[model samples]
Target: MANRTSRDVLLRGLWVLGQGIREQPGLFTVGVGGSVVFGLLTIASAYVVGAIVGEVVVPSIESGRVETGLLGAGAAALLAVSVVKVVGIFGRRLGAGFMQYRLQASYRRRVTRRYLDLPMSWHQRHPTGTLLSNANSDVEATWFPVAPLPFAVGTVVMLVTAIAALFATDWVLALVGLAVFPALFALNVVYSRRMAPRQVRAQQLRAEVSGIAHESFDGALVVKTMGREAQETARFAGRAVELRDALISVGRLRGLFDPLLETLPSLGTLAVLLVGAARLRQGAVSVADLVSVAFLFTVLAFPVRAIGWVLAELPRSVAGWDRVRHVLTATGEMPYGDTELPAAATPASLVFDRVWFSYRPPVGEPAAPATADQSVDPTAVGVPGANTALPPVLRDVSFTVPAGRTVALVGPTGAGKSTIAALAARLVDPTAGRVVLDDVELPRLTAGSLARTVSLVAQVPFAFDDTVRANVTLDRPGLTDEVAWSALRLAEADGFVAALDDGLDTVVGERGTTLSGGQRQRLTLARALAGQPRLLVLDDATSAVDPRVEAAILAALRNSEIATSILIVAYRRATIALADEVVYLDQGRVVDHGTHQELLARCPGYNDLVTAYEQAEAERERTRSGTGTGDSGGGDPGGGPARAAEVVA
Candidate 1:
């Protein structure tokens, strides 16, 4: 059984190589043709040397006189063969390198494109670190064997031709050639079998180590702030040590077999010489024949090792191919239709018709019942399923934001608010029912149509390491500086932006680290606004800004000339009151919907939730004012009587 498994692995590795050859047949042909030229010349060089020794040198020495012309011809033949051999080596190396790099680059693009095509739910099930590994190191490993593949193939031709030459000269020497070659092949097969599992283990460990390191670095702030740097370092080091040991195991196996592979060819040359001497005495072969065969074996040592080089790399190639195939063949790609929405400058109305959604359990995990109020764990987002065992996060929820109006989604933490926002933006599809925009189902519209019509600003702002103009415009065509400035003004971010050293040209650093939290939030909001989206979903996007700034930004968006419908996941009473209407949610169900005053008067849940939020806001204001460190005149420190009246009326 073990032998069968080893054979299967070897065959699979060969299959991967075959796929590569088929994919780039032109380059493979060019590489192999050059190698074959080198091989044939190698055989010719051996014969030429043998001929020179038997004909020119031996005869000149026997006669006790130098033949200058014949010596010069022999020298010219050797030099000419050497020149052609160099040309062949250059072509072989060039072709092999181009083929390998091109294949790696192509597959990396394909993997990255696949990542973009997969839905948010699919991305949630995978780690960013693992995805990066799959695109980079794994793709590199899959094509690693291509470097030596041509040389190995050429060596096979050389082996066959040399064996025939041996038999043509002397059948007894042919028998020696046959024995040494088979032993060499057998040793390589054994080495590959022993090396495969170790190579595969090492490849897997590389990805794990990358994942741990990325996590540790990505959360560096958390690690430092929580004083868990030592724990994080230990976690990273533990995986790094495993990867180190795995690579060492691979190296040890290669180290053991390399010398052995080298020794087989030397032994073959020894056997040829021993057998040739006996043949010379028996008159079974001429001196020239014996010399040629012996010289062939000596030169064959390095070329024969080419085969071992290829076989040794096969395990790693197979491992990388398997990993790449996982991404290429992954299920749950979100499909889009060709339908396009009609172009309109007016706001697009959004509606949820009995929409229900539940997070599926990850593969092989039995789902446990959980409340809608329970927080989502980032690591456990699951694969798609037809039905989930856990309770739905949103159950028969229905609401609408009419065109040219603002609707506030008022819910306690984790009442599926963000999920609803995602649904509205078509970042995800509801498991049951549908979300419609402008009277069209989201899935039926083309991706471009959906993108043009709606934009989502996530709760946590993200910015690329780029100029302010680039971050706001996102390189989208036609979003000139004028448009970016307008959006920044609408988001209440233009003042600080104008004060920057280079204005819009200044680099923001990674994830906008050079900017304050409020500044980053405002910048991201401006980015969304610059898209000129008809329906905008803010998943508590302005939480980092001062409450007064947040309220002013909302008011500007509500009164903007461009006309957009807004769905905001809001917590502050002031922001909620700014909405044209409020949807009160409790435990994933819509408890009520009405104007702020109507809900405050009629619904106890709404009243209690708003009162708690008001108290929290008042406490934060008191702390800020007492410390004398708050933004000057930012919010009403006494929880403004006018806003309270608006809520109470």
Candidate 2:
């Protein structure tokens, strides 16, 4: 079974290689044609050396008279061969180089498109580092053989030509030289078998190392805050060391193979010399024929080595190509909808219809997509971690917010609040039910339409290393200062924008490192606002802001001239108070949902969670007071919490 799988992988690589050849036949022809020219050049060089020795040098020595014309003729023939050889070299190198270039570029585009097309579940199953490697290192390795493929063809031509020349000069020594090729082939097959597994391991380790580095860099703030820099460094170093060790193992095997490849040709030459001496004594071959036969072996040496080069790289290319194919063939891609939202307007109304969803930690390749039977109940899922067979995050959940209204999602830390928000935005489809917007299921809307109509702003905002205006506009055309200023004002982000050195043109560092947490969050919100989306989904978008600023922002959102429907994940009283209705959740189910006062009067769980928030706020306030850094204006402090709780009770 293992052998069959290996053979299948090799066959797939060959198939892909053939496809590449077909795509760039002209380039392949250039490389092969060059090799053929070089083969002719090889035969000519050998023949010239033979003619010089047999027709000129030997006669000159015996007759003690130099023939100027013969020497000139030999030199001119050699010079002409040298010129043709240069063109051959150009053709071989340029053709192979261009072929490799096209292969890398083409595969990179396909892998990237695959990444973009795959759904959230697929992205979740695969690591960011692995995906990055798939589009880069793995792709490069998969096409590594292209550089040698045409050269190998040339080597074959050289081999056939060398064999004919050997026999034409003297059939006796030709047989001796032929023995070397089979030995080299046998040695290479054994070498590839020993080398392949290590190359696969090395390729995998490289991805691991890349992932570790990316994760470490992404969480640099956490590592710094927790003072785990040394630990992170040690972790990175460990993976790097493993990758280094795996490469060394590959190199060691190649080291052993190289010396053998170099040694065999010399052995073949020695055999030819011994046989030629015996044949010359027996009057079977002339000195000119013997010299030409020996010369042929010397030229054959490189072609043999070139053949080894291609065979040596085969295992790695196959291993890498297999990984690339795995990603390209991964299932669970969301079947996108062709229904474009009417260009006139998007009637945004978000609803959850008997919705159920569950997520499992990815185990390995070929992971199954979430299905109804496999869905875990959120109540039983416990806290999401490595536990695979967990419950659903949302169960039998159904609700809706009419256009131009705000609906707040209130829940405990793990009560599926974020999942509900994700559904509203169609980031992931529901496992059992549907999330409809404007009377159309989100899955039925084209991606472009969905993006235009719905916008989901994450809590922790991401900003590119670009100007604030560019970040706000997100490089969308037709967004002028008027539109940008309007959105910034709505997000309450204009105050900071005006303070920046370059105003809207000021550059925000990578991931908005130059901005404060609150500033980044506001800009993220502003970016969404600038899009003028009909349906706005905020997943704790204002959690990082001071309560005062948050209140001001929410007031702008509520009273703003925009008719956008807002579905925001909220915990603070100020944010919730801004909502027209509140949906209270306990565990993963909606316990009760109504006006804040109505829910406070009836739902015990809703009241308790709000009360918990109140006490947590008071405790934080006292800590701030003790630290002599209390800022009452930033947040409501504990004033609303106690009063709100009294109304609830």
Candidate 3:
């Protein structure tokens, strides 16, 4: 981003202030009105000094009399001035509080809404720390301008009013005080130029700190297991130190600017006093007029100081507003079709037509074989790249899940099985292909229509920090006990849920940490089953379940009325044997596809892979039985029996 000039910062700050008022006009009007009254009262207090001297002190000295009536009336008038001063103070504080509160509340909500509306690809580029800071600190910074804006405006009004009164008493003194105006504005511009880029850097560093902290916390388990606590802490501390330095730089500049604003009004008053003394000696000005002019300049100091406050915050406010606007106006929004999916009268038959897809690397990451621009459709009318070095994840892959038939996708790691499942669920769009469900293209279906038509249960599932029931329902309207219980039973989670202390209402810790790995997996499966989507997808969703238990769950799914077609990403024989057909994928291509037994007989690659998987499973079974029987020295102290089994495989 280009460095913002002083004028640009001030203009953007003003725009943010105007936007706040537009959002809450009534509150803004009340706040500004109060500040104006407050400003007038502050100036009036200065006038009372001249009033007391001119009206009571002058006459008493001339007459050489203790005039009780005159003295008593002056005291009464002073009391009235005090009362107005108190009211003005209250109004100014009230207005500033109101506007600040409204601005913070409105922007926080807007930032959250924008995050939800942004596409997943955009989210992939931005970290949790950036989004969190945008919602919290950036929002607060955007509203900081609101705190000083109204008071600053009122001060300007009071200064204009005080000057008119000053000139009415004596022209020369008023003119001397007016010189401070341009000088004060000049000070503000200089401060903005020095702080604008620094404040922007400061805000970015704050997000960096937040991101590092969040990463450390999120990966706490991994760090703990790897015994890398010092490494993680050092990573976080590095960013924290940088953020501290940035904030100090901005603070140092502010320190210099604020005092100068404060001292100028005092300097103007001194200038007026020198001129007024000479004018009084010439008998050209009365003591009362000279006193009034000097007092007015002293009163003007407050507003001048407030103007400094507004200017000091402008650069940070501009930086924050720019970040917020970037989010609101972000491009790459996933455009969905207007058409809804056809009603459930037709079977949900899924097909991938000569499909091709690939992923582009994020900024600063090593470039992937396929660049983003190279993600152009291979099927485009005039383009050609049916075979590029950047092999499409699902290169010219085509398959069909006939109505009511289950298909199992068996493949080595990175064979694009999960990618294919994502396409079927419409979580992502294919770069050069059409994924159709029930004869309708996947992209043509509205979000809601696609959601009900198919449901995907990811390999690693997430549970909200809420009750088990809420996690499944997502608090969706119209979810009933029967529906939830049936899904749980099919997922083989009913037994464990019934055994829990609080049943369905029990609160699950973040990511269901309170639950065992297999238990969390089952709960995730139950969540998808609860919705009873027409087409269900499982991407290694049951990998953690016990083999015997997994068999029961697969049996229940095969016999269930809810899903007509199921797309399973599987490696286990029990799972693949249950499928009506199998698709064998090797290095992203579908090598051969048939029933489990047919593939084992005909496809050499499929047989070897499955045999390897079977041998591995057999080793795991032997290790578990040996551990139970107190063999192998009653299990190794390293705490993972699977490591030994993996070595054997």
Candidate 4:
């Protein structure tokens, strides 16, 4: 895993660096040119110093003839060297800034694109916090390798030049200086090997901490209502502490190796000083040669040590790159649909043929998860520290909903009602069998066509931290204010929206925190309806709103001239009553399909579900009206939790 991870990360970082250079070659040229110029300047400065010591300093002292011309030449050389150094420094900063911006923009987009393309099922298995961390810290970590490459290359090149210069002056001193390079490189490699896995662990911990914190923030109401604030806080704190400790371990390793890397060059310098002095006493080396060699050694050691540090950092940067690559190079969920879909707004029929699916969650290792029900005991199938078995959430399930019609899904919690709706929208795909839209398999449909054809309003629609108009239109260009208002009216959201202080321009706050549950649900429905898709899939979207508002929304949906297929996944009787047919799912298979009256007559489970929903809603209403002795919130509902989904049409 470590070797593969390193290779993957290394290749990706270099590729990203190459892309940066490819995009803005001028900036790349500046960065590269500056480093090369700096290296040459150092060599020139060293040679000049040697010349001064030999022709000017020594002769003047020995013959008592101080030449002003020689002193002036030395000053001119020093001034020239300083000017080159200044230019190089300025060019490097400008080039690095441009490179950093260009690379970061591309990398961020790549990460986002990967996330967008991944199957919804893939998303379900991973935590939001980990994804957040991948986008932030992981991307930044990968930046190190790209940003340092120019410097690293320049350092290595300069070190080589210095070594060659030493050899030309005296092979003995050159060999001594060269000997330290191998030991320093070996030390770097060892430290890097040890740091890679630890860094990976640390990255994961950081993600976990972010995920926990995000969850807490998103579910603040639930935590407070349940009086579990302390518990959740402690859980988050534990994760944070884990990440901190892991980072400290990384810091400790860096601390140890950095000092050693710095000290190695000093020790080499000391050896050179001692040996050169002894040689000078024996008249084996000239004073000028010793001074030039020492000057060259100082210049070379700095770059050599810097190169060593960069090498040590490569593994960690690569570890981050591996994480990013995991997302970028992952097999996309389902597949793209390239087949042409009709441009007409008419509803498209959906068909399922021998469909089979299984959920693969992210587990303890880097392997794809196993089937959900096979009981590959994590402990038994573990590869020492690796475990990759996912708890399967779905299996072979098959059913169909004709075009220009409505189908209701009835099932126990986790029985795949929402999963089926998601599949219809191509949010996910079956492991086996095909889900076809208008006879064209979903995987063959182009993404734009599929999106236009299958619209879904999921339970709990995500509201952004933007104005109501932006939220309703969802930033889809060409969706005018007039059109947005029409959607709000259709979703029964206009009334509440108009009452707000800023009306359509009011900020919704993060996740629509400022709005009531019913208002947020209506806004989500309005956004889904804005596109006017051909097939509308709503997974219990009305669960949060009051019965009156839900009834009004249902009436509007039934009355709308959308001419589209609608699949409503709900436990509420009112929603089922409006459906033309009900498909009852039990376990992982479809048990029955028919109209409400027909299902009530033929399927016992269908009747039970309706009876349960009626009782639950009645209880809620009685509690709200203060006519019931039970708790106001119901604590839990009889028909199970109602997750508000989207209205795709």
Candidate 5:
């Protein structure tokens, strides 16, 4: 039952991978042809060895004749077979290597495309390392079957050739060799069945370890600064040890199967030699026949070993193929609709209609037994038992931003401010209501059109490890040096950027580690500006820059008359003080909407929040003045300098 289930899954996986190969006929041809050539050469060598033993070695010994021609012919045939063998092996490697490169490259690109298609909500739950590993390591691991499979099947052909030769010599010995096959095949099937699940577990553990390591590496400074080095190390070491143990478990099974596969073939050879020797002594088999059978068994044994190796690796490769297919087969977050949003002659307005959303929480595990002795522990959580459900993240929410206007979102940490910003950008779609841009539904806009229409500047701006110009321009093209610098200047970042030794050409370390947080934040704003978006959504974009620099950037935006709608998500009153309108959210529900002055008089929650923000700023300044440190660990780097400057607005 187990063997059948594993084989079923294995075949299904191969069928999917084969579809990829079939779509690219040229690559498949090269791979298949190489294997065929190698198999033919292998069989030819075996035939030559058997012929030489029967026609030369035994006859010459019996007649006391020196058959020089036979010896010469055998030597020449061996030389020819050796040359073919080397050529076949070289071609197979070359072809398989090319196929692997092409497949991995193509699949990686497809995975990236799918990632872009998925919504921001999906990205939150999925770790960076897990996705990265799938696109790289998982895809690469799948290539193992591609190289070994065709050759292994070709060996099957060689097995048939050996059986035909044996039958021609003697039917009884041929039947004996055939009988050994079922036993050998049964053992391989059983071994593969049991090991497949183990291999799958090992691969999963490897992915988890990779995710943990990547997370740790990315947050190395945080872990060290918080004095959690030992804790982080222990966490990472636990995952690593689990992965190691899983691999070791699978390795032991592989060790046993490989030797058993090789040794079992020897037993078949032993049976042939014993039975053939007895037949010859009874005069039932000729001397030449006995010699040929022995030679055939010797040649055939190696193919059995090759077949066994392939069988052992088959499960792992199939499991990898399934993982790759999971990503390939997934339905990504691309917008679906029949209508398209038309290009605007001028920037248009945004409106949200009774918007409601909630995170699709992770599937929970079943409750465990209270004690360790119980089969179902009360404390342990296994896969869910179908009674529990996930909770909501957002409730009814609605707001609007007119063309060329600025709107602000203020709320507590978990009040769904970021989620709203993401929805506005169509980074995610609302569950119960529609977001319309210039009257067209958000989901109807094509990716290109949507990006041109809206741009997001988040609190934690992403920075690629590349030149400043490259990171700023990102995937967009056609921006000249002057245009890039102009955008940077407008973001209040040009001065610091120009101070760098390489200027805009300087390579930023991983995630812009070389730059200060404020600088990185400004660079992201510059990127958004470079897009010349119709709607610029800043989700705490100025959180790192000094309040002084942030005011300058905002002043530039207010004065430019660029006619782009802006949505700013922030807690600071000064950040949104100049906004034409404000939307105050409390516990995922919008409780107030109006001008800042209007809300201060009518909305107590809004008034209280502003008061708290002002009071906190005063307290922080007092502390800084008293201590002479001028640091609170959270203020915008440019905030202090900006606060001291006059704001024309």
Candidate 6:
């Protein structure tokens, strides 16, 4: 069973090499051609040396006279052979390097493109660090064997020809050649069997270590603020130590086999000398034949190890290929349609028709039916777990934001507000029913059309490390400084931007670390606005800004010349009042829908939640103002239904 498994691994490794060769056949051909040239010349050089020793050196000693011309000719011949051999080596190394690097680069691109193609749910299931490893180290390992592949191929040819030459010279020497080569191959097989598990373990550890490191670094603020630096360091150190040990195991095995592989050829040389001297005495072999065979064995030592090098790397190559292949062949990519929406400067209306959505459990969890009577279509919108019993985040939820109006989604925590926002922008498709834009189902619209018609500003804003102009415009064609400035002004971010040293040209640090939280949020909002989206979804996007600034920004958006519908996951009473209508949600179900004052008057749940929020804001303001008014009633400075009514009026 063990041998069968090892043989299977070997064949798989060879298949991987074949894939690389097929992808870049021209480079592989050039590499192998060079290796063959080098191999043939190497064997010839052995004979050349033997001939000089037997023909020129032996005769000269016997006559006690040196033939300078003959000696010079031999020198010239050796020099020519050495020079040609150098050219062969150059070609072989150059081709192998180019082929390996090209394969790595190509697969990296394919893996990254696949990441982009897969759905957000798919990405959520995977760790970012693991993805980074798959694209970098794993990709590198998959092609690492390519570097030694051509040399191994040429070495095989060299071994075969050398054995044949040995038989032609003398069968006794050929017998020695036959024994040593097989033993070398058998030792390599043993080494590979032992190395396979260790190499695979090492590769897994590398990914784990990367995952822990990325998580720690990405949450640097949380780590430092929570004072868990020691725990985080220990967590990272644990994984790093395991990776170190795994690599050490790999190195130890390689160390053990390397000398044994090198010793085999030297042993063969010693045996050849012992047998050939006896043959020379019996007139079975000449001095040149004995010398040539010994020289060939001496030179064959390093080249023979090329085969070992490839075999040893097969395990690592197979492991990396499996990981990389998993990413390249991952399913659940959100497929798009060819339907295009007609271009219109007017706002786009959004509607949810009994939309139901549920987050899929990761791969191994039990999958029960989502609903007893609701049948799921496997081909519907590429949403996994539609048949699973995972409680739907949104259940039979129906709402609409009419064109040229604003709708606020008022919900407590875990009320599916963000999910609704995601559906509004078509970042994800509904598990059941339809999310329509401009009277067309979102899934039926082309990605380009959907992107042009809608924009989503998430709660956690992300800014690229780039110039302010680049961040806002994102290199979108025809968006100039004028457009960016207009968007920035709408988001209330223009003043600070204008004060920057280089204005729009100034580089923001990674994730906009150079800017304050409010500044980053405003900048991201401006980015969304600059796209000129007809339908915009803000998933509590302005939470970082002051409530006054947030209200102003909403007012600016509503009164802007550009006609666009707005969907806001709003928490502040002021912001909700600015909406034309409000949808109150509780536990993923729409509790009620009406104007802010109407909900406050009729819905007890909405009234209580709003009252609590109002009292909290009033207390915070009192604290900020250093006043001990302690007014927590309805008539406090933080307004309830009456204040919301005033804002609306």
Could you say which candidate leads in TM-score? 6
Residue pairs with colliding backbones in model 1 are: none
Q: Each prediction's TM-score against the native?
A: 0.90, 0.89, 0.88, 0.82, 0.86, 0.91
Question: What TM-score would candidate 2 get against the native?
Answer: 0.89
Model 5, position 521: C-alpha lDDT score = 82
Ranking by lDDT: 6, 1, 2, 3, 4, 5
> What order do you get sorting by TM-score, best first?
6, 1, 2, 3, 5, 4
Superposed model 4: Cα runs more than 4 Å off: 1-29, 49-72, 93-97, 170-172, 180-183, 214-225, 283-286, 336-341, 345-356, 363-404, 431-441, 475-478, 593-604, 626-649
Q: How far is candidate 3 from the true structure (C-alpha RMSD, Å)?
A: 4.6
Q: In model 6, which regions exceed 4 Å deviation? A: 61-64, 363-384, 614-649
Regions of candidate 1 where Cα sits further than 4 Å from its true position: 59-65, 362-384, 388-391, 598-649
Q: Candidate 4 at 386: error in angstroms? A: 23
lDDT: worst 10-residue window of model 3:
630-639
Q: Tens digits of per-residue lDDT for model 3 on 322-379?
A: 8888788877666677678665643478998988775544434654465564453547
Estimate, for each residue in 372-472, the C-alpha lDDT of model 2 and write its tens digit.
65455454335333135345678788888887888999988888998888888877777667788888888888888888888899866798999999999
Which should have the higher lDDT, number 2 or number 3? 2
**RMSD after CA superposition, every candidate:** 5.6, 5.7, 4.6, 6.3, 6.8, 5.9
Candidate 6 per-residue C-alpha lDDT over 14-116 given as tens digits, one digit per residue, 9 for 90 to 100: 9999999999999988888889889988999999998888888989999999889989988998999999898889888988989999999999999999999
RMSD of 4: 6.3
TM-score of 1: 0.90
Write model 4 residue lDDT over 1-649, tens digit each, in one string: 8767655554554575565568778876787677767777787788789788988999999999889999999889889998997787677667766776677777889999889878787787777877887888888776665555566666667778877888887778888778877777778667766677777788778778888998898776567656789999899889888889998998999898888888877787788788888888888778888887777766665666655555556666666777788888877455684688988968888887766555654544454555555434333333221244344344445678898888888888777888788888888776666898999998898998888788888876688999999997878877899988888998888877887889999998888867656677778988988888788899887777666677788788768876678888878787788888888887667888888899899888878978987897787666555633332112222112232111111
Report the poorest 10 consecutive residues by lDDT, candidate 2.
639-648
Candidate 1, residue 555: how far the Cα is off, in Å: 1.7
